[model samples]
Target: MEVWDRALTKRVDPIRYDAETGLKIYREDQLNLGKGGNTPLCPFDCDCCF
Candidate 1:
């Protein structure tokens, strides 16, 4: 249905985004997928990406 759907269905890629250039890319990696493993918890004072 969507690119994400295709990626997930295939399940062999890493999704990447570069905020500076607004570029998005995807590739395959068996060890990692989806939001990465551990991310720093959202900080209350941060206005970034909220």
Candidate 2:
């Protein structure tokens, strides 16, 4: 086991860790959802087009 994992296994220690936040974070688990399209939307209703 890795040094980090060994440290985490130390029972009776006050730490917050669960299955959802597992010891390892695989690349697949990380969701990279950026702006779907390059087109950007205006923040407010402007008459720039009109």
Among all candidates shown, the one with the greatest lDDT: 1
Q: Which ten residues in a row have the lowest lDDT in candidate 2?
A: 26-35
**Which predicted model would earn the best TM-score?**
1
TM-scores, in order shown?
Answer: 0.24, 0.13
How much does each candidate deviate from the true structure in C-alpha RMSD?
Answer: 11.8, 17.6
- Clash count, one per candidate: 4, 0
Q: Distance from true position, residue 21, model 1, in Å? A: 0.6
Per-residue alpha-carbon lDDT of model 1 for 1-50, expressed as tens digits? 12333334553333667889756555533333443434455343432222
lDDT of 1 at 10: 50
lDDT of each residue in 6-41, candidate 2, tens digit only: 223432322434578555332321221231233344
Residue 15 miss distance in model 1 (angstroms)? 0.4
